[model samples]
Target: MRTAEQVTFGGSGLNRAAQIRGDAAALAQAMADPAARCLPMWRGKPLLRGDGLDALGLIPMDHPVLAAGLGKAIRAPVFLGLEEDGAPRFAHDLSRWEPEELDYGALGSFVDRSEQRHPDLPEDMAFAELRRVMTALSPRDAELAATAKAIIGWHATHRFCARCGVETVIGHAGWQRDCPDCGGHHFPRTDPVVIMLITHGDAVLMGRSPGWPEGMYSLLAGFVEPGETLEAAVRREVMEEAGVPVGAVSYLASQPWPFPASLMFGCAGEALAREITIDPVEIEDAIWVSRADMMTAFAGEHPTIKPARRGAIAHFLLQNWLADTLN
Candidate 1:
């Protein structure tokens, strides 16, 4: 399990400057430093370079691309963390100024599928989806992108205070929202989810959601309910989704899945029974694949089922399981 951090979006050791977030003067000092860098995002796509999906583009604070994207608007920057050299880094959401006439390609119903354009940036500076290329990114880059996306997405959805229904303003270096009326302070939230790798002797249980591409399967996952432990969540999810009883659940690894801010807790579960009674609502299909069949799937030689995403925790765990490297 020590290889846990090696999973995509897991092991970035960014020194999150938590102590200075509330210090306005310290924040200003960091921002004014020459080494200060800012990452830009349009819609939800982050600006990245290079030919592969793993590339992330973090420009200097004085970059012209940002000025062209947002004009002179002084939006609050999210202070992600500091680099190993102590240079401060921040992220700005430049999704406010997208041209109305560009094609964004195909998209999901709830996604911001439109890619933005800027007069100052080259064509290769386009923002792209994080899920498609998270594995290709350096760990720090992935963490920064995930942090920015999650905080920005939170600000977008939670503009008002739940306590008194008052509009809240960003504060605490974009980590908190303050309600002027009720003295309420709100911080960003990271929801907990448990994704299970269930084993039954030689086979592993995998499930397919209703809308996933045909033959695509992955570890069964579900959000943790109030007051549920990680072990309990794994057991509950496996039983609820696949009607398979589980025992002795153990943690393996974790990942920051910022498809709008989630911490995926990867766990191994010993299934008490192999028979699966699929929950029609939770998943469309449930099947157990023998270790040999999974090897074929991973090698792209399987006739039907495709492998889990290469960098995702599911695939990481599966690969290790096959290699007997789950320590």
Candidate 2:
């Protein structure tokens, strides 16, 4: 897994500045400083700039959109970290704003291509879905966008303490939630998932969910259950979905998939047999695709199969496998 960190959203080595998260005095000074910048997120979409929407639209603390309260702030801005020049970065949740003629249908779909614009913001800046533009963004911007989306999503869903069901308040510079009633502490969640590259000789196992677009296939994957190891999860998931026994599972790479907060563990496994007895309830289809057919699919020349989405870890693994670089 030499190219593990090269995966999209793998990491950008951003200075997290964790030492000052609990320092009230320092946090206040940083918030008020002119060097402070914020990336406004609307409904899980990050504000992006540039003609190709490749850069984060970070607004200054005193920007009119933020100062004039154009879009309501759902919560206090979360401190992201420090930039290369030691400037503080923050994420603001502005999901309350309702844009004109917003396509409600596309807001939260399998692939949300809808973009929203705030009237006061510059024309080049708009809230765009991260999945659509993740590869176009710089590694630093991609990491920041994923971090912002995951943290804000956690806050949105986990507003109450699990211990007492009492409302919690943001603390630790947006990295934690504090419960006033029971003194309970809660942190952001990142679910562990295993995406396997199961193969038998020159063929790789692929499956498609029930509602996926026609011909779309990807490696078998499932969430890691409690008390289950990564290797065990890979074996169990493939067996459950495709009825294929897997052996010799090994770690390949990882990606911070912030589609509502998930960490994808890419693992390689050797399939025990080629026979695929798909469980209809778990997967709609399962098949062993040969290396030659996989290359044709990746090239968009196969009529019956479409490759996995480009930015996903599945595609990354498949690309490396085809290039013989999955070591």
Top-scoring candidate (lDDT): 2
Which pairs clash inside model 1?
1-327, 54-136
What would the C-alpha RMSD of candidate 2 be, to one decimal place?
Answer: 1.5
The global Cα lDDT (0 to 1) of model 2 is: 0.90
lDDT of 2 by residue, 43-87 (tens): 899999978889999999877676543223235788999989989
The true-versus-predicted C-alpha distance at residue 248 of model 1, in Å, is 1.2
User: Mind giving the per-residue lDDT tens digits that candidate 1 earns over 1-327?
Assistant: 868899887788989989879999999999888999998877667888765545777778887666655412226678998999999999887877757676655445323434554667666666777776677788889888888888888887788999999988888898888999999998888999999989999899999887677688998999999988999999999999999999999999898887888899999999999989988989999999999999999999999998887877889989998988888
Total backbone collisions for each predicted model: 2, 0
Q: Which stretches of candidate 1 lie over 4 Å from their true place?
A: 64-74, 103-105, 109-115
Error of 2 at 3 (Å): 0.9
TM-score of each: 0.94, 0.97
